[model samples]
Target: MTKKLIYNGTVLTMNPDRSVYKPGYVYIEHDTIREVGEWPQDGSKQALLESASWVHDAEGKVIVPGLVNTHTHLFQTFIRGVSDDMPLAQWLRQIIWPSSLAMEAEDFYLAALIGCIENLKSGATYIMDHHYVHTYPENDDGVLRAMEESGIRGCMARGGVDLSYEPKLRETEEEIFANTDKLLDQWDGAASGRIEIAMGPLNLYGCSRAFLEHAAKYSERRQLISHIHVAETSDQIENTKARFGLRNLELLEAVGLLGPKTQVVHGVWLDDGELESIARAKASVVHCPVSNMYLASGVARVPDMLKLGINVALGTDGPGSNNCQDNLEVLKFTACLHKVNQLDSTLLPPMEVLQLATVNGARAMGRERDLGSLEPGKKADVVVVDLRKAHISPVHRASSALVYNANGNDVDTVLVNGQVVVEHGACTLVDEQEIIRRAQARVDRLRAKLAPEYPVFRVVE
Candidate 1:
């Protein structure tokens, strides 16, 4: 097996017991870490030659487990910043759906690729993409190809939303099931261990009970996680209550969708009982703090969720909602916003926030054993951030600096499964500029071609 050594850095394992920052050297073999310690020492030269391939000097940079994005719509990269200030319903009904409907398979491929590239460069090694806009069968193939090309580890959910205010957005039950099955068959395990597929049954208010139950069963029989949107907005909560006569989490539990392998995205309006149910079920929650604030969809009770023993992961949501796919910003916003919202600076402590972005996120994605920490036997999913920045000066505590002060721009290098995906703040596997150019061209064409058809939102500049 191939091996590599990364030494001379401060390592944060993100493990519950050994989560604190400590200086160390890590040795990796193949895709798994072999050994790690506070200092490097000479080993048997013959054994080293037989296994080790290369060695990297980290130069005292801070090494942390790569960030995990629990929820994202990679195909929405083209709509980033288009309707930044709109509410959740307005953003979805007006700007997002129209643009998404206009997007072709090629456009989606480019956009997903761009999203993956940007994510890796920003220190996110794994992303759980709730990729919902598959207008055609070919679109699924294109999205999978883009994920393969980026070399990032992710679970791509073939998202299906069967109800919308617009009739065109609604789909027949047969169509949704067929598409989800086709997507799963096509790309479930396409990239050796890097890419996997899951079922993303849009949201509670958008999907029927039959659809949710079917999707949950399908995922269970296939041994895959059930990815779904829960309690995202106040209106959705109200609608769920009105129609089902139960709250959102209660609806999910009644539908038999809440369990150990379930991941609920954007749970911004859950009540106390719902929170307890989530913890008891051992399910996960994706906290999109910036997106929630952007859409006025109430801040998630993440600090409380943690207290109740729920796994709270970080997410950027979709570009249409968050306007940017940056986990660094998610870390910062979650740490600061929750503390202020709860009026307790002690509420999401620095180390806890860091865990949400790292280990908690990995757990939410069902990849904690392999990808969450800088420990021996874990996957070499790692990120190196420059600690010598002006904003990060006089670092009293590494964890505090990481959650409160560090930005995506500080991520200088990223490695996924021991392969360098992003170096010097740029992706190594794809042409970043070419990806951006094609993405912009697709956006421009879609806007120009569909401008006249859209009445609620202007598609043109």
Candidate 2:
């Protein structure tokens, strides 16, 4: 029954009409937004403002719906800067796989904590974490614990690779399904409904056709979302075609995996027919521009996907791949990468890029009715960007400044579920410094344990 009022800010309501209110005020009652409109400066509403339990004066700030990171690997935070400037296959074979094998449940917990803190400070309210490094059952529990403690809302896509390309950390088909069911029983609808469990079969190369069909059917029956990496690299598509005589998307469709609730990450090498099939199925594609460019995975046909009526959302991929958990960076890169790739400056305007992170992301998560926009009756997940910074000063357009000029450090305050989780660019729920310290400690241990087996690559400065 606690009420709060945030007034005197530039509000970007990503509504259907894309309304922007200057000197706006958002009234909140507990976890829901009660009203969003221009601040009543006259004495007529002074009495109503005085009735709120708490009031936040957001002068010289821009308020928008909290940025949504539709896909990420929270457990990969430990592997940041470990394997860079390498192709996806070699990177996984040498550094990532070995490091994952040496990690324990505690390592996963600490890494997820660090990742969640980084995401929160970067104005992200929700993270669809694809945690596939479950060497043990406690590994799954570790990630869930970190998400709950970090106070961020998200879906935990418990991922597993059955047909392992690597030597260790492989589970059988029965074991994968049983573990997934255990996770669903324990974590689905947990964290006061802030965390949801989804089915995450690692990818086509790592999972069998039988496993994919089983995961899709289970996800549909349980009313959960199914997430997987699809056609991210050219090698994957070629290998799938070589093995099944079908492309990745064709295989998925043949197995009945494409649907509204299915989210395919990084559709970089898809064909025209595959794109049409995805749009027809009402499936979503999460474009990780930074990760794709960093891993040299080639650019996704985002414009083509959008033109075909496919729902496209933004993702940071993984901390290991992108080396940062900032959605602002993702937002800016999504806008710029397409324009340069397509050689058209008008493509992917600021408003459209911002929508990919907000409403489109919510649609990918199937929570469009409740989350995404700063509309009344929606959950009060909002971010306040301080525009007084040197880079963001002289703002001509709020949306333009948000996407182009501003970065994650400009995020001053973040509210998830009507509770302030970050204030003045720091997390409020967890000890961020301590999380970083512990995560680094775990990383050190992992590196030492795997050093003899996998030597570090030296770089000349």
Candidate 3:
């Protein structure tokens, strides 16, 4: 029996009561947390330290539930900052579409490796990657291989767009299902169940009704989540309404897709009725604050969604849109962006924002019972953030320091399933420098393949 102990840290349980144990300790047996509370009253600490196989003194650090990222696209790591300052529509056509055609199988593997490392360094132990680009037959497989190698908890939302203008990016309903089935057969619940599969139909404009219905039925039958982008921009809302009489969520409902396991990404232009619809269906809406602001895609009604009893979670989106895969960065953005949007200082306090990333994110992934809190019997996915640093010190509130001040660099350690995958802010399973080098080579090669007019090749004056 492998036993591990992380003691002398400030523990944010993220439980229903929002418990915090200053100078607390957590005991893990195998892959589950066996005990976690304020330094115990019993004289078992010394005995535990002596008996545990691994021990880490977490003094001057804050231990948090591993951040859950409900949405992202790992394939974008190669083309992030290159396509900047463009709206969603133009960004898709000029950057993502062109890059999709240029990317090869190896490119997907390298992108997922670096993207997973970035998320680990950022204290994101659980990620729902909405990876949709499937230009090559082995592209998704390479991504799955990287996910397995990274040793982080992940859900690869295999994305398909049957209605895209870009032929290379489009897949027929049969192709989407066949590919999804193949991936599920090979990778679902692989890596000791750290990896999962989800059906990701791109969006209203990108997928046909027949395609969506097939995806919904397949995912529902398998008890997997159906993740999709919806109402991200005003133009999408108008376009979908024009093409189909119903709005994005309305169409999803018509196709029997709106349910508890549906993850609706970027509900930016949703109306009150639509918000209520999501709440009634018990579906989750992921808020990607940085991406929304980056694309000038208006802020999602996160606060209102929370008020309507909808499960609202946080995501960094794809790096192509967010420019980085740092979920911790999303935490700060979510707190500040919504407060400014609502013009209310008292709204979305630090603890509440933390919930959006932790517990709410777990709920979004249907793993709330096993993955969200530091409670006993939960998965031992924890992060230790060094709070003794310059920007985080004086030991105010752990939650405040985390959401308002702490960046990804503040993360000192990350553990997934009781395994120390990142120690001292570096990935343990793979050579970090090597991953970055390979990804850059792939990006350089990809850029060579794309036209000069693409944002990546445009030389800034």
| Decoy 1 TM-score against native | 0.94
Task: Write candidate 1's Cα lDDT for 277-315 as tens digits.
Answer: 999999999899988888888988887888899998899
Q: TM-scores, in order shown?
A: 0.94, 0.97, 0.98
lDDT of 3: 0.89
TM-score of 2: 0.97
Cα-based lDDT at residue 403, candidate 3: 91
Query: What tens digits encode model 2's per-residue C-alpha lDDT throughout 285-307?
Result: 99999999999999999999999
**Candidate 2 lowest-lDDT run of ten:** 452-461
Q: What's the CA error at residue 155 for candidate 3, in Å?
A: 0.5
Q: What's the lDDT of the predicted structure labeled candidate 2?
A: 0.88
Error of model 3, residue 181, in angstroms? 1.0
The residue-by-residue lDDT of candidate 3 on 197-306, one tens digit each, is: 99888888877888888877888898989999999999888887888888988999889899999999999999988999999999999999999999999989888898
RMSD of 1: 2.4
Clash count for candidate 1 is 0
| lDDT over C-alpha atoms for residue 167 of model 2 | 48
